[model samples]
Target: MILLKLFWSFFQIGMFSIGGGMAAMPLIQNQVVNLHHWLTLTEFTDLITIAEMTPGPIAINSATFVGIRIAGIPGAIVATIGCIFPSCVIVSLLAWIYFKFKELTVVQGILSGLRPTIVALIASAGLSIFILAVWGEDGFSTNPLTINLVSVLLFTVAIFILRKWKPNPIYVMLGSGIIGGAIYLLI
Candidate 1:
């Protein structure tokens, strides 16, 4: 029954998450954090970080992580399969339909319309993460004492480094990890 629930949960995520991994964050958060109570909000944010650092799509990584946490290896396999199955079917069908209707203005218009929606989804996910990182669990407090100085500093420095040097993202991640670790340990 747990396995069935896991599969159904991820299947819904895969089916509706049209834009990609970033756009899927809210849906994944809803299923795993809000609906199933598999992980807390902080854990969900950590999951997103881990998922981004790893090799595959965020949705698949999230499914596997939540499944293993809840029901071990078998849960991971079932959840992963569930997450992938919809994308496999949808992409295949869409590919055929797209090629057949490649010349239609309606198809072009539909594709154009989706661009803004996808951007909005990605922005919403990014803003949620930023708020969580800077403001703790209480969320969006205007009190100065409630803010995490370390997180704000790290975020600012990261943006500066990225904008100024445009170094490899791996280096930025590594540097941030090392700095964050050192600061947290000292504090």
Candidate 2:
């Protein structure tokens, strides 16, 4: 039952999410957080951190992680299939007709326009994660008027510095993790 549930949940995600990886975050969050109650917001953040650090699509990694959490090895199998099946089918079909239809103006136009939508979806997903990271601590009392403002300011400053200096994303993520850890300890 758990395996079936995992499969169905991820299949729905893979089927509906029109863009790749980051574009899938919102729906994945909704299913795992709101629908299934598989993990809390804090847990989702942790899983996302691992997903970002690992190879493979974020959505697939998330599905496997959540499935394993639910029902171990079998759950993982189901989730891997759920995440992959749609792409396998779609790509196979497209491959058969892609050459013949490659010059179709409508198809070309649709693909071109999809780029912006994909970017927008990924940006919105990032914002959602940022919101979660700011205030997802359970039972930790934070003064919204003071601490929240500090956090927001720090986040803005970090982004500004990152953009200006242009360092490796890995280093930035590691730095953020260290800072988050220190803040948690302090609070």
Candidate 3:
């Protein structure tokens, strides 16, 4: 029953979460954190971080992580399969349709229409992550004491490095982790 529930949850995430992994973050958070109570908000944020740092899609990685946490290896397998199943079917069908209707005005218009929606979804997810990182669980308190200064500093430095040096993201992530670890150790 637990396996079934996990499968269904991820299957829904896969089916409806258009615009890729970043866009899927909210839905994944909803399912795991809000709906199923599988993980806390902090854990969900950590999951996003790990998912971003790892290879492959974030949704699939999240499914596997949640599944394993909930019900071991079998849960992981089922959740992974569930998360992948919709994409496999939908992509195949869409590919065939897209090739056949490559010149259709409606198809082109629909594709164009989706661009802004996708951007909005990505932005929303990014904002959620930013808020969580900078504010912790208290969530955007105006009080100065509530803010996570270390996270803010890390975020600022990361943005600057990304804008200025344009280093590989993996390097930036590693540097941030090292800095965070060193800071925590010192304190």
Candidate 4:
């Protein structure tokens, strides 16, 4: 029964999350934190960290983690089904029409408009993550010095490297995990 519920929950998320992983964050947060009582806000934020350090889409990684955490392996399977069902249905329907209309001028114009909106959505998600990561559980920036100079430097360096080098995202995730772990140990 719980498994069914988990699967259904994820299916809903996948089905309705129009803009992909980033857009799903708010929905996931609402379910995990407010609706289901599966995890607290702090836990939800932490899960984002785990998702980033894992190798997959944020939505999928989050569903898997929350599902497993809530009800072990069975829960994980359920949640994954839920998360994927929406995408599968939507993609199949879209695919049927996509090829036919892809060359149309109106379709092209719509896509061009959508690109910026998608980018804005992604940027908003990033800001949310930044708030969660730096502000901690109380949602207050708890940095002793008001700002972490090292992190800023690292961020600039990372941006520079990424701009100049088309490195695989997985490699970047791994490197970030290592650096985060190192920083944890150091501080």
Candidate 5:
């Protein structure tokens, strides 16, 4: 029953979450943290961090991590399949439809309109993550005592490095991780 539930939950995530993995973050949090109570908000946020730092889509990485935590290898397989199944079907259908209607003004207009919505979804996800990193699961508070200054500092430095150097992201991530680890050891 748990396995089935895991499969169904991820299948729904894959089906409804448009605009790629970042857009799916909120839905994944809702399902795993709010609905299922499989993980706390903090845990979900941590999982998102791990997922972002790993390979593959964030949704798939999240599904696999949760599934393994819940029910080991079999659960991971079922969850991964569930997460990818909808995308497989949807992409296939859309490919055919897109080719068939490639020249239609209505189709082009619809596609154009989706751009803003997708951007909004991605932005919302990024904001959620930033909030989580800065304030944890408790969310923002009027008192500055609860804010994570280390996270904020790291975030600012990362942005500065990106804007200033324009180096490959792999180096930035590695440097951040090393800096974060050093800070962790110091404090």
Candidate 6:
């Protein structure tokens, strides 16, 4: 029963997450963190960090990780499949329709409308993660010290590096990891 619930949860994520894996983060968070209570917001944030570092789409990686946590290897496999199944079906249908109606103005307009919605979804997901990372457990932390100043500083530095040098993300991630580790050890 838990396996079925896990599969269904991811299936909903896959079906509605129209933009991309990052866009799916909000839905995934809602299900895993809000509805299911399988993982704490902090753990979900950590999972996002780890998912970004690993290969594959964030949605698939997260599904596998959450599934494994809940029900082991079989859960992971089922969750991965659930996350992908909707995209597989939707993309195939869309491809066929797109080729057939590639010249239609309605289709063009629909695609244009979708672009902004996708951006909104991705932005919303980013904002939620940002809040979680900065504030820890409580959204409104009374103690200023509880706020993760290091994370905010690292985020700022990462943005600066990206804007200035445009280095590969892998280097930024590695640098951040080392810096974060060093800071933690020192403190």
Candidate 2, 37: how far from true, in Å? 1.6
lDDT of each: 0.93, 0.81, 0.93, 0.78, 0.91, 0.93
lDDT of 6 at 139: 80
Least well predicted 10-residue stretch by lDDT in candidate 3: 133-142
Candidate 1 regions off by >4 Å?
none
| lDDT of model 3, residue 64 | 93
Q: Clashes in model 1: which pairs?
A: none
lDDT of candidate 1 over 14-74, digit per residue (tens) = 9989899999998998999899889999999999988898998888998999889999999
What is the C-alpha local distance difference test score of candidate 2? 0.81
Show model 2 residue runs off by greater than 4 Å: 137-150
Candidates arranged by TM-score, highest first: 1, 3, 6, 5, 2, 4
Clashes of 1: 0
Error of 4 at 81 (Å): 0.9
Q: List the residue pairs that clash in candidate 6.
A: none
TM-score of each: 0.98, 0.86, 0.97, 0.75, 0.94, 0.95
Residue by residue across 24-71, what tens digits does model 5's lDDT show? 998898899999999998898889879989999999999999999888
lDDT tens readout by residue for model 3, 1-187: 9999999999999998899999999899899999989999999999998888888899999999999999999999999999999999999999999999989999999999999998998998999989998888767888989888999999999999999999998999999999999999999
lDDT of 4 by residue, 144-175 (tens): 66555555555666677778897886676677
Q: For candidate 6, write residues 49-118 as lDDT tens digits.
A: 8888889999999999999999999999999999999999999999999999999999999999999999
Root-mean-square deviation of Cα positions for candidate 6 versus the true structure, in angstroms:
1.3
The count of backbone overlaps in candidate 5 is 0
* Model 1: ten consecutive residues of lowest lDDT: 136-145
